[model samples]
Target: MAIVDEELPTTIFDFLPCFFQVIGIMVLVSWLNPWAFIPSGIATMCMLYIRYRFAHCSRDLKRLEGITRSPFYSYLTSTIHGLKVIRSCHAENICASEFFSHVDTNTRVEYLFLTTTRWAVIRFDWVTVFFVAIVTLLSIGLRVFGRQFSSADIALTLSYSLSLMGLLQWTIRQSVEIETKMTSVERILEYCSLGQETSVQRLPKYEPSINWPSHGRIVFDNVSISYFQDSPLVLRGISLNIEPG
Candidate 1:
């Protein structure tokens, strides 16, 4: 167990204290550096606070963007359906203005949403840089002034400190990204959670047969359909009649 340069690979489990839930205790007692946690703890707390602060606002902004976009889509559908009417009325300029007006709200919110994410990234990076600086200063101070660490010890400290910074930044960035992306899932879940229409089985009092053109007349009246709830129907009371020879 104590040969120089030919020592057996250490396995603490076979030696002693290998019972029950004592694995973490072994790790801490063997390799834990108490000083390493300081900067990491600070960075983690700051990351959590920023994530929490942005959560509600980010969701609301995303929802607002959806609302604003609906108007533009409706306008596009309406314009396509009534192209001849629009051209006959000579309202291209007016229609274009209205479309842009509807789209303006969506553009503003989308811009702000992107900017907000960039702003958070900058802050997270700043926090990481500040932590690295603190670690560097402390390592040098302890080695030079305190004279408690050898050159090899200082090198090890610096290496670990730098490595941990990259890991910390990646963790923060990934956490924010996942949280932001989950908003889409939340929206889907919300839509799904809306009470579903119940089924009621009944015989139709007036079920029309598929036989066509027996009398050579077809008609429709007061029919409405909307893709989104609360949206205006794409076709409203569109009454029409067709005659066949």
Candidate 2:
């Protein structure tokens, strides 16, 4: 969503200067103006602070949500596999309570994460508004006090001011989104670096006859089917032997 939604507009906003200054309508009122850069810097600093402050919180929230979700799914699978055993053991209430607790915890963490996101959005919006006002005010001051620019130039300045603010807002919003998205990215990287088991540990090293399975024999001493712990056995006490050379 960040790449598709946020990054797209952010890249488009990169064309703001070309859209304005290149057209000769806004000459001195380019994004390189001190008014634009100063406020942009301040807004960026604020966003950086916010990201740092919420950095640990965001990771913890994702972790908690993952923890809660896994157990809920585990419980569901176990329940489906062992409904009869759960009922027989009279653990229906306990199971239901555990499921609800997981759900409730996950819901709370999700809500908190959204709230933090909204708070960041609002802060960026305020910065955009303030930046716009500063640019407009400076342009007007230049005209009224020093008569340094003509009406046409003033109009151009105002337009560029608004455009610059939009560009600033877009860039900052994308930065915030990427910051949050990085948490998920970091977790994925961690998962990618996990240890993997080799099939040789489970498969026999011995090789069969050259024709392979020519005299293969099948045997089963005790094989059972149970999806999870504390679940009813779907199959048990099974034995079979088949030789088909």
Candidate 3:
């Protein structure tokens, strides 16, 4: 899903273009007033720093949202399939409560994720404000020092400097989003790499006879089971016996 929905189109249509715009505009702004690079460079560094911090938080939030969302959908699906049985058992209220509980939990996580995004955007806006202010001051200082920048050059520099705010924010956001979405691909690859159970094979020369187990008894001892190797055991240390009746 991430591969199709995000990685290809977002990278092509969004991140790359914004990234190039940032670079090209910065270069052109510097050509107007070489001193302009200082504030732009500072703002770029600050944006990267903010992005690093925000990415870690947003990545975890996205993962949590995914985790919380699955149970909601899973429960909703199971409830749909079991509606008749639930009604017959007079468990509608209980089922509804459970469903709403899942909804509440999912909503909470989603809200937290959104609020964090808003917080990052506000901080990005602040950084952009400071960047523009410094650029304006630099322009004034250059003029006072008889560096004589044309009105057109000053306007272009200021305009591009203002535009950089949104472009930088979008680039950082998209890049982090791409990284977070890649986690889905990571999970898929991990699932693909898991060990599979081998199929039983019977050869003509080494086949077991139908009545080989004449005792009609089976036994198990100290068995442990888990769905995945890295996951905790669901069943541990069980012993059982089945004897011929």
The model with the greatest lDDT is 3
Better of 2 and 3 by lDDT: 3
lDDT of 1 at 12: 27
CA lDDT of each prediction against the hidden true structure: 0.65, 0.65, 0.85
Error of 3 at 57 (Å): 0.7
TM-score of each: 0.61, 0.59, 0.78
What 10-residue stretch in candidate 3 is worst by lDDT?
2-11
- Model 1 clash pairs are none
Taking the tens digit of each residue's C-alpha lDDT, what string does model 1 give over 40-139? 5776688667767766567677667766877989999999999999999999999999999988988999998888777777877787688778766876
Residues 63-160 of candidate 3: C-alpha lDDT, one tens digit per residue: 78878988999999999999899999999999999999999999998999899889888999999999999999888877768668877878888998
Better of 1 and 2 by TM-score: 1
lDDT, model 2, position 46: 71
lDDT of 2: 0.65
* Candidate 2 lDDT over residue span 59-151, tens digit each: 577566655766788878988999999999999999899888878888998898777767766876776687667767776787789776777
Off by over 4 Å in 2: 1-36, 54-56, 196-245
How much is the lDDT of residue 59 in candidate 1? 61
